[model samples]
Target: MSAVYDTRRQSIALSIVVPIFNEEEALPALAERLRPILDGCGEPYEVLAVDDGSTDRTPRLLEDLRTAWDQLRIVTLRRNSGHQAALTAGLHRSRGAYVISIDADLQDPPEVIPDMLTLARADGLDIVYGIRVDRSTDTGFKRRTAAVYYWLMRRLAGSFVPAQAGDFRLLSRPVVETLKTLPDQQQIYRLLIPSLGFPSGRITYQRAERVAGTTKYPVHKMVLLAFDSITSFSAAPLRLATAMGAFSLVVCLAFLVWALTVYATGRTLPGWTSLIITVLFFGAVQLFCLGMLGEYVARIYTAVQARPTYGVARDTDEEQQ
Candidate 1:
């Protein structure tokens, strides 16, 4: 499974796309662990470090590392366009037969690359998902929320959406091209790729802790990611909203029946508590439905704009010329 790659080959066999934000603390260690694995593989590869408008020393560190390692390519974005956009940029730019997207945080082990490559080639798989078998390294809250997320996604996006699979995965050329063709304004590759119904395989790995730097994905970002995942992949959320509205209507009807009974029996209360509660409940239900509709509407609006998700400020490969 471990073979020497021919550097003289004109075509690149593999491309490792790493989405970096402020990963200055992790870059060196990432290269240390990642380069050896790539070098040992029997395919000529390039590591694409996408700088998502880092406000820290991440860009400078990437440049320094690239200076020493020619295989390291830097794709600097004009602004921080978020994780998914950074990934979209790298996937579009990567010119390899197979591309693997990973994070610079070193949580998803680089040691699994050869195995992923071997499995994909052996089985002729278009996608190889790196599933986290043990998430004990993650906080309890993180793990629980992640479990719920996968559960909802699988139920909504279909059971084919693998549980515990994040963005760490290998995509063959065909899969990469197919992803490129998608017109999604906000791409959630986790669901988007699996929905393609491509022949795929999964490799389980123990999830590790971040090597350095604060986590870019806080609670808010996780919520947003979940929102995007639900909206972009399935119309289930909208359906859920409709169901809630129907339930609210039923409740309102029941309340109306009760009020009529009270009025006919001459036992109607003068207190405003019941009226205020009813108003608040109905208002809350309406707002919830509207929010769900707004999410889809916002996506439609962005799609109509047809704006690029990310802009490349600089490319080391081009700069070399």
Candidate 2:
């Protein structure tokens, strides 16, 4: 089942894209486990180990692995593009009829890949989502935050977004081509994919602990990702800002009426506390609305500039020729 990239040959059946960032510790385990599952599928496949500007020994390790495993292709980015950008690079470059994007961390098992292919082929599905059914291995905080994220996304981005599905999923060639045409600056595939309204299926699996290395997605990155997801998918935040502004105006009018009545009755307070509080409240509302507007403006600027999301430092497959 060992397969290698042949430029003259027909298209590969499957391409497993693993976006790696400083994943030196996990590379060996990932390769050991991932290769067999893909190999056993009895298909001509290639594994695109997308190196997202790793600052560790990841680049060298991938090179060494490719020496032994010809199917392993190294697609290194010139800089550390974010996860979604790296994924975009892989998807755009993949030569497989079916593409599956998975993280280098083994939390989402590679074993389920064969089942995904079988299900897709038999059911004629264009997308197969790897749904997380049991997350007992994850911390309580992580689980809670994930639940909240998915819930909010469903409400705002539409209910098509599968809960607990991160980037582990399978997409057919047609879906991949469709994604390439999108002009999104921040690619949130979880929401973006489902929004396509494609023929889809799901496969459930229990989450597992990382095989090695620390997590790349820290709390701050998670927060940033949430913001990106929110801004990229929906205008709910801008609408919420509008509602806050209206509420603030109503409150200020009510206070103005109270102040006039107090002055007429000669019971007006001498202190400036109420005036300062009102000023601060209004100021905060204005600032919040401006910030929401700024987020959308920034996205427009990025789209107008048409800057490349990622730069490829090297493609080992291309070098081989």
Candidate 3:
């Protein structure tokens, strides 16, 4: 009774990839909501629950849920390779005409998926995004920061990542295949998706609070995710760093010329104050450029190694095979 049966003969129309990380508390509720919507869609679909090395009972819960649903499949990563890596793993493993990715925390509702699919079909879009309409549940600081981040990303990245759109979205088989061919270690799925240049649409919905489980994406992790998204997609930061260094150098040289001219003209004396200021400013600029260059170089080094994005600790599909 292998779950990994060849689907060429009987084409699977849909697959839902739910990346779980320590979501033990929300498993039952998630299943209860998802199963009915998936079943009612009238398209053959499978749910791939990617367990991103949960330390809690999330793995055990996924096993039990798989037993309850015939189309449910599980992929367990060896360790926490991160949310984006886990998502990429699930996308690669899925076999369906269309694939939808969502959070296991139940914040993204499964009920809206049918609408997304319908819109995709009607509009001939390769991808459909779920955009959050309301962030009332989030803190004011978080809400404002998210707004600022999205605005900056749109302006700087040269990619129109829709405001308030998360990883919860649907992709056609062609889009999924195209996505699989991308080979980057530091993946930013949201940013990369738009670069495909496929016809896309968005569905707006209010984002609800997590049904259960502790929030896995804390402030620090959120900041890192933002950095990863920006750095992975656009060279704008690196380019800005270069421009800044050039500007600083020019300013320093201009000041030196002015100071030397003043000395020559007997207008002022060469003193520590001006020299100290110039030194400090140049030193800060150099450090900033070094940091920016290091970020890009680190990403290149990671890609050169070509390590698999994630490892599988235990797979229900593997056992069935």
Q: Across residues 1-321, which tens digit of lDDT does each residue of candidate 2 receive?
A: 133346422668999999999999999999899988887888988899999999999999998998898788899999999999999999998989999999999999999999999999999999999999999999999999999999999999998999999999999999999998988466889999999999999999999999999999999999998999999999999999999999998999999899999999999798599889988999999999999999999999999998889999999878756
After superposition, candidate 1 runs with Cα above 4 Å error: 1-9
Instruction: Name model 2 segments beyond 4 Å from true.
Output: 1-9
List the pairs of residues colliding in candidate 2.
Answer: none
Please provide TM-scores, in order, for all candidate models, with all chains considered together: 0.94, 0.97, 0.92
Q: Count the backbone clashes (under 3 Å) in each candidate.
A: 0, 0, 1
Pairs in steric clash, model 3: 78-311
Q: In candidate 1, what residue range of length 10 has the lowest lDDT sum?
A: 1-10
Candidate 1's TM-score reads 0.94
Give the lDDT of residue 252 in candidate 2: 90
* TM-score leaderboard ranking: 2, 1, 3
lDDT of 3 by residue, 1-321 (tens): 443434421588898999889898999999999999988998888889999989999888887887768788889899999999899989988888889999988888888999999999999999999999998987898899889888878887765677788899999999999988878475787788887788999999888888987888889998998888788878888888889988997997899899889989999965789789988988988898899899999988988999888987766666655
Give lDDT tens digits, candidate 1, residues 69-101: 878888999999999999999999898899999
Worst 10 residues of 2 by lDDT: 1-10
Candidate 3 at residue 170, lDDT?
95
Best by TM-score: 2
> How many pairs in model 1 have backbone atoms within 3 A of each other, for residues 3 or more apart or on separate chains, i.e. clashes?
0
Backbone clashes (count) for model 2: 0
